[model samples]
Target: MDQNFSIVSLVLGASTVVQFVLALLMAVSLASWTVIFRKYFAIKSARLKTNDFEQEFWSGTSLNDLYQAAINSARQGSPLQRIFASGMREFLKLRERHLDSTTLVDGSRRAMRAAFQREMDAIEANLSFLASVASVSPYVGLFGTVWGIMHAFVGLSNLQQVTLATVAPGIAEALVATAIGLFAAIPAVIAYNFFARDIDRLSIRFDSFTEEFSNILQRQVAPHPGQGAAAPSAGPSTRPMGAH
Candidate 1:
């Protein structure tokens, strides 16, 4: 048989339900691939940007200068930058008020936590859909295959004798549903898993940066040599936000 009368013809000639199932699977597979490509780039970019920011942060540059740059790039800053900006901004505001070290730390922590949640939410967008496609696509394809086989056997009941030629086309068409289902599911599953792992690592990095920033502030909060003897007086909290 020519190529046109093979699987292509089988699919084209499939029952209405089987054809619908195949069409649905193809659509899902296409959509899943789109998400896979998009998410691959997005998560990778986020990780790379986070690494670059972390390097810049610990390079002993002045905090105020970094904070200023962060503010300027606020629109395009990575998750790390956003979290730092939120904490540092709150720290600066509280310090200007002459709040005690403990209160300053608390406010800064709150600010960073809020910012962290927002960034994480952005990173996690659409992951659930990928997961859904991965988990459900196979079953959907199996449903199509089963329906196709039933359809073939239904036709067989009308024949006087079953032959390979009579049975092959129906089974072949039925199997296409499963093939398309696997095609849709496998990439989605792989991409979803890859993103989950990468995102998790990024999450850990964000957490570590937050804690380290808080510690730097905590050090500034402590009294200087012999200053503990006198009452604590605050003036911009020793410039952790401005890191002289």
Candidate 2:
């Protein structure tokens, strides 16, 4: 019994197809774990960076100063920073042309939306692979199980008598493939769900920031009651502290 029960022996005794299936599952398990770890760190870093940048953004920093800083260190800025930068750049460009306020705001909004899509694309990279692994592994394992059991029954046709010893090992080894599949799948499924939720939250936050930021820019584009064309151009220095 001890001899028959060894995992290595069971695997070794498995048919070529079953062995291939087991190996495939193992490989998928390894890849899934690798993705899970990488995604974990990536999401954590994004969240932390977003939080830090948001704090700075609402801390009464002038948009011009913040935009300058963000542009200078753009690589380190969060998604929000990128969105702001895109919108600000467009807004500034339109303002330079002395475009109508409506056109300026529309162009800025369009630029921000485009930036938002790009940032989301970057953030969600490789997530589909994780999702595919999670969704497909279970069915793959079941296929292995079916193949192994069918093979086991076929082998019994050669025997005059059947016993637990004859069937248990074959069935056990076949089930191993299923277990390995589940092993590969569960964490991937969990991580995919967790990441999806987090990403959704981040998207919402980014969208909210976009709306608020748009309003601030709108105020700048709109002329103040007392100030006419003589008022200094609404640069970063002119941003209202409370608008953020």
Candidate 3:
């Protein structure tokens, strides 16, 4: 153990470039792990909360009750809850104006769609950094390796005799950087892909919920008394009084 520690110290001391590369790899590893764990918990919580909310939403609960619940506990509510709240609020607003069924439904759909986009954006935040780390780490490691090798060769040029022991330590130390980079990168790439797929699935669920909510709105509006009601004109009619 002491010998290994001494070798590591030697490697770290021999090339500043290697030390920098290792430090970068360590940072990437820490960041990737943190994101992985955070996203895991976040996605898991979202899925569970979404499932619970869906059950309540479709279980004959009143829209007003659901909206209130969502507003009060919205931090714990999932994307579905927010979308439903937006749609219901818009539906009520349009209903108050005595809009026709088609217009009311259209307005509600628009609100839900906007909410869905917002939810997706939130869920996908920070994913780009993970992708960048995965893609760039290997190149960064290679740069360190190249620098270390150049340093070793420069030393070799000043030596009268070249031997295996003289060159092997530098090469081994250089390769360690590449290995560390791969260690950091591979898991990050895999986790990024996994999380991306999960988010896509959740997005699909959000879309389906929007469609189902739209259908529900259509049903609610279809039987209203204001089926084809239009807005009152802002100005007086142009026709002359009693001209008919």
Candidate 4:
């Protein structure tokens, strides 16, 4: 509480090991914040783009038209768009070979699944680092605190007359390491949980889309009564993915 006992002085006066711990914690905290912000915007943009694409897709737009648009906008395509493009491309190619409904649907589903995995991997990149920081930083800081306390006690052992004033600074400086560690950990924990939930929701969305699109493909490929092989519908079908 003394004016001379500011945080800056406490950190500066900390032992070398504690100082190193603080520095490491600070660097980790900075990196975590960077990931947090980047992931936040990335996920937000994905969700928004997905909604937009879904709306367009369900607006009775033609499948061929959608596929063409997807191809033209490949660089700006969202995860959903890429998944749709992959499935549609595979379906069209296999349909040309006169494959049965099951084979057509299965091939398209596989393509979609592969695209889904790739997108999920990209979305989850660097997420493990946040998890690590959240789970391990506290222990790292604790190690520094323990080391600083031992060093303080070793210094006190040589004193002829140890007093509260002599011990307070050492203990305070040591506790700062723990504080820094918690500071680094709490945000990473919260961010990791939030990003995890968001990513899970996106995964579910992708899964649902995959199933719904597969059904549509199946319907198109399946033989109709009294009619030979049906061609792919030029316009979008009546069925939707599902309600959100």
- Give the winner by TM-score: 4
- Please give the lDDT score for candidate 4: 0.90
Per residue, candidate 2 scores C-alpha lDDT tens digits across 1-244 of: 5987788888898878888998998898898888888988888888998898788877767777778887987877788888889998988887788777778888998999999999888889889989999989988888888898889889998999999989898899888778878988899899999999999999998898888777776776676688632212434533446453
Q: Model 3 scores what on Cα lDDT?
A: 0.80
For each candidate in the order shown, give its overall lDDT on alpha carbons: 0.84, 0.83, 0.80, 0.90
The sequence of per-residue lDDT tens digits that candidate 1 reaches over residues 1-244 is: 6674577898898899989998898898888888888888888888888888877777666677778889999768788998999998999898888878888888998899999999999999989989999999999999999999999999999999999889988898899999889988998888889999999999999987888788777776766776631222233332345554
Of 2 and 4, the candidate ranking higher by lDDT: 4
User: Which residue pairs overlap in candidate 2's backbone?
Assistant: 64-236
TM-score of 4: 0.95
Q: In candidate 4, what are the lDDT values of residues 1-244, reduced to their tens digit? A: 6854898998998899899999999999999999999999999999998999888877778888889999998958889999999999998898899878898899999999999999999999999999999999999999989998998999999999999999988898898899999999999999999999999999999999999888887787788898766766855472464533
Which residue pairs collide, candidate 3? none
- Which order, best to worst by TM-score? 4, 2, 1, 3
lDDT of 2: 0.83
The reply for model 3, stretches above 4 Å from the true place, is 1-7, 224-244
Instruction: Please give each candidate's TM-score.
Output: 0.90, 0.91, 0.87, 0.95
Tens digit of per-residue lDDT, candidate 3, span 114-150: 9999999889988887898899989888887888888
| Candidate 2, position 39, lDDT | 84
Regions of model 2 farther than 4 Å from truth: 226-244
